[model samples]
Target: MDAPPTEAEVRDRLPAGAAPFAGRRTELAALATAAARTVPGRGRLVVLAGRPGSGRTSLAVQYARSVAADHPDGLLFARMSAPDGSPVPPGRAARRLLEQLDAVPAGLLPADPAAEDPACAALRTALAGRKLLVLLDEVREGAQLLPLLTEEPGCLVLATTAGPLTGIDAIDPVILGGLDQGAAVDLLGELIGGTRISCDPVGAADLAEACTSRPAALRLVAGRLRADARASVTDAAAELAPAVPAAAPQAPKSRGATKPRGRGPAADRRQARELLPAEPVPVADTDPLVAAFGLVYRSLPAPAARMLRMLTLAPTQTADLRTASALVGCPAPEAGTVLEKLAALELLEREPAAADGTERYRVPGRLYPRLVELRSEQDRPAEVELARARLLERLVRLVDSARLLLDRTAGGNPDPLPGPLRLRTPAQAAGWLAEERDQLLDAVRDAIGQGDLDGSAGRLVTALLRALPLTGAAAPADLYQLHELVLRVAERQQAPRRAAAALLNLGDLQAAEGHWPQAEEQYRAALDRARAAGDEPACARALEGTAGCHRALGDPVRAADWYGRALALRQSLGEPRAEARLLVRTAEAHTAQRRFDEAGREYRAAVAVLRRLGEEEAAAALSQALERLRRLVDGEGIVQVSE
Candidate 1:
């Protein structure tokens, strides 16, 4: 498996060390002291918690690099959260650590629960005596760090998260805030050159405060200034000022209400001029961060802006050309062109090509919230809905088509898609599904929340459920959640047929997981809905599911009856394939009861149907079963039944 970045690689990825480190000196010193401390039985754990783009990651990396020589054994780094805002599984994190340490052979880690514990224990033992530095970045939960923490006294662990990791012993928590005024100015000087700062010292200070001294916001401002040397610091500050909403004047005090004194308009205007003399008064109802994003966003072409808004639909804030094309309803090449332009503007970071040779890009996490806000503000709710519908429709169709190519038994493909879509081979289909699973799941939830599932959302859910078994990308819990979302949407829309389908899917999933009672309950509910809606196909499906549940629960008599009913329905509906399958199932139920004669007759009937349908594989298997049953009945001196 491909490993995440190593300690040195992570450090190298940080903002340039040569750039002046202006702030967080105290926090850095404390972190360094913690990392330097060692005990006999306890390892050091230091967590830096702060908001997005608050320089938590930068500070952690800087501290680690500054004290890199303290631990001579090795430095390991792992990102404990995915780019899509999901926590990485503890097992995977542990496996990666073991791989990095060379404690286990590559590809030898077993996924089985019984075998995983021993593997983890062995890895911990391997690290028992080593003096190492482990950097876990972007940790969303403490459990994600449990597998990586060692009892080795000489080891040091430094982690960064959006919030504090509570319930951990001996944790030194540092809450990183914005840079102070002087430090923010110094950082700007380092990026924009000292000469520019000296030319307008007051303007530089104003720019720092205008950006709220957030390192990320400051960096964006600096990048803009750096790109255009002719652009003054005051000009940059003016561009960012609109992000700061003006304070609304307080209303006059009533008998019991108190009103605070405020500065006069003239004084306020004076202060504003000192801050950014070139800019107009800031408007209310705007976020500074969003304002900063707007400055950069407005610089792009219309297509790029449109693409940025469309990109918000991606939960992970990351995409390749294929997903981008689907979201934007454009050709892959055009989507690629827009992505490159965004990358050039630093709106999106271009990642290295994945193993499958597909280039991926990530929208900076700091900008995700603002992008969403912008989308909501710029695009109407209906327009957003339409765009989302198109995206879901395309993804559903694509995945459905891919599954058909991969599994001939997967049933019919979806209706013809409008645009030119890429069709992957069986081998590629699995990889594609895995890559897009998170996005698809997120889209499903979003559609449900927006009450826009009547068209493509329901179809996407159905297609995804069908594709999951073939790809194995989603866990059973994830499937359950998706189905539950579908169920809610179906009920909300008063669509009985959709509701029945969702119930049947839920029942099938529960049966696969050995929850027979729960599965039966769902199947019964589905049956009722199917009957109410007069949907024969759904009715047959529900009946078949109930039969399977009964069979699994050791009630073959009931299973045979239910299967018989389903078989009759399929035959009446002219569904030859479904009828043959139900016959095989019903025969198995009879075989379990030692009714060999009945089982043999059903097997022969199924084989004939399958042979006529040109299903060679199924027909051959049934024929062999029929032969075995015939011999068993002959040896037992049982009467043969004629079909």
Candidate 2:
């Protein structure tokens, strides 16, 4: 809270034999200059992009040290670990920064960033006036981290990342590159006592070339050289390779920053493998992010390989023990063990306890892109299907639970009732529905692809219709663009039952909005299809659609006739809820015609049906209708009888 243990502590704590922060003096200077821009009225964003171990951390750390004096208020270090081998996700990073700033308590972050943003915004408010140096490191998801940086003029934000954060270009970019040959050689000499290396020019150049000039690699090679009194520059250069796969797999680490046991000899023959690089890694050769990741991941053991792929199929970017276990066909404990190994190897990262007191793990940013590529190639249709099934099942249960807040009851069958479902009030429910709009649609689209039109098309039409009137939301561009997707599936699959049901709902929607002519077309078409399929229930709904449109257009006579037909059909089909609603509508039509006696009789029947179903809301409305008719027919009749 009181200015994160000063830069002095960090400097003193640097690992023994770590390079003397050399070769990147200019770049570090540039970062310092950027950090200085935070002058109480203007804020600065400095993004340092480079591959892992390209010394971005060293430069950023050194810059933090240099700027420490400028920001006496506080200097906060939140390792949103792209290099700490753990990918600190935006929410976790934000929470970490909040914790470091003493803004939010450690356990208050929400399970998801969507919910965590408000907490982060609160943190920003708390930090807004402070002169702080905040470093956001290893940003895999830039969008998530941007909100955490205080925009206050007093705070300096220096973010270290794998590449440009596409959405956040507001910051100046400093891409850290490996040192040039001379700088590399000079720095290696400094580490191993420059005098010894420079004493033999050719040997020093060879050593620098072999070191790939990357500070980490340089320090490593120098550590090995200094330890071996008999080792020559040529021998050390030969020991450090032109291409030591940036991957640091867990070999029993040797003492004092030793190079891998076999890496030096591998580099001595680098000229033979001209394609190999001598530097820390050019951030080239791996054309895409996946390629770079592939170079790192492809070397893992087969079980680890499968585990990595399974994690990619996780529902969210983060995975809990259960999710990992299911995906890997292992138990939770076994999954956690495997996850532990992945984290230890720096292939995965764990999030801090979220607001829910639950945590999840994920692949680091440095490894995710390659995992994505490997996953695409390795993900069989079967595996994807399995994940898809689990997700869809979960979604359906959630949606069903949501509907319970509407007071919808279970049917009369003896099936167990769903668990008590809680949701926000109607207004909040609508908002939530809006937020989940895309994910819900995505699920339906996938279901349609799987040839399940009844569920996909039906739920989609129901959701869109229900949400639209409440939300008045401008339909998403993609929603309208792909609205016809499920319709097409219904059409192609020859499921007239589903097709007619879809048409009836669409037509009913059109009719409700005063589009009578279009409504008539869809309803008539739907009616014909329903009749063709012997779907009496669907046919009745289609007729009801027609009657509602006609009634809205000032044709009570036609509405009455259509309502009668639907009522008879529903009675024949023995469907009580439909019969009750139609009966109530018919009674209103009779009242429209001033046939008070017939309207009273019909309304009484509706009240009986609603009462039996325990629909208090509907039964009350029916009782009101019957009393209105009684008032018209017999003025002396009591509208409310005294007991």
Candidate closest to the true structure, highest lDDT: 1
lDDT of 2 by residue, 622-641 (tens): 78767666766667453332
Candidate lDDT scores, in order, read 0.72, 0.59
lDDT (tens digit, per residue) of candidate 1 on 432-537: 7766666677778777777755567778888888888786545565677788888898789788898898899888777776778888999999999899899999
What residue runs in model 2 are displaced by over 4 Å at the alpha carbon?
Answer: 1-284, 287-299, 352-359, 364-366, 372-533, 542-565, 589-643
What TM-score goes with each of the models?
0.63, 0.45
Residue pairs that clash (backbone atoms under 3 angstroms), model 1: none
Report model 1's TM-score to 2 decimal places.
0.63
Range of the 10 consecutive residues with the lowest summed lDDT in candidate 2: 412-421
